[model samples]
Target: MGRSLVRHPGVRGCYTAGNKRFLQLNELDELRMDVYENVKLYKEWTKQWHDSKITRKEIIVGDKVLLFNSRFQLFPRNLRSRWSGPFEVVTVFPYGSFELKNNKGECLKVNGHRVKYFYEGQPIQARGELELEDLPSLWDE
Candidate 1:
């Protein structure tokens, strides 16, 4: 005792794997199977999952981080390229954004997503000949 299939132009029967069957409970079974599959797939997708990530959340202002430089523009015909380098975190704004200073010591403000962070940050030194003592020694400083 199940409901009938949705009427087709020229049929009063049901379709299984391929062929037509006359008045079986096929439609009801198919509906039940589809509902069960959908529920199963949703549960599997929403189950708990683990991912490797840095657990620390104490990045404060004045910390140094490395930014990423990529040529691809998010907007069409964007004039300036997204530039990145060792920048000092100058000020943390209200939201998840911070003011940054570039390698030349110029102040520029940017959002969090636009700049990436480095765990072991390095100080920016001038190009050409940078001697060992000229750069801030990581261990010593």
Candidate 2:
């Protein structure tokens, strides 16, 4: 059910079959859901997460985090470009997600599942130089 292919180009996000919570997420497809789930949880709970285990906001104006460009984008990440750096939390939308910043500190709004904490071992990157550089750019500035 899981296998790391060499990665063929033009393969957008993924193609999942069913909704199996206990499904074997062995291949990258399985992990893809994880990314989706993490961001989703963040999206729904940004308010309650302000000072809780959320640690980071979904996409506030000034929080620092990461963003995964959709496979459909012109410069979308492949096996090589799938992951980007720690972006800033530019603005949090009423819908739940937030605007994000890239390594260059540019604003790019994204959903919760589309982004992560920015750290190793953890799905997204943890806060560090990446987030700090872009934090000041968050909303209400």
What is each predicted model's overall lDDT from 0 to 1? Answer: 0.68, 0.64
lDDT of 2 by residue, 27-124 (tens): 66868988999999988789576647645443346555666756666664456756577776766777667777677767765667777676536467
**Worst lDDT window (10 residues) for model 2?**
14-23
Q: Evaluate residue 84 in candidate 1 and report its C-alpha lDDT on the 0 to 100 scale.
A: 53
Q: What C-alpha lDDT, on a 0 to 100 scale, does residue 73 get in candidate 2?
A: 67
Model 1 segments more than 4 A misplaced: 1-57, 73-83, 119-141
Candidate 2 steric clashes: 23
- For each candidate in turn, give its C-alpha RMSD to the true structure in angstroms: 12.2, 25.4
| Residue pairs in clash, model 1 | none
TM-score of each: 0.42, 0.34
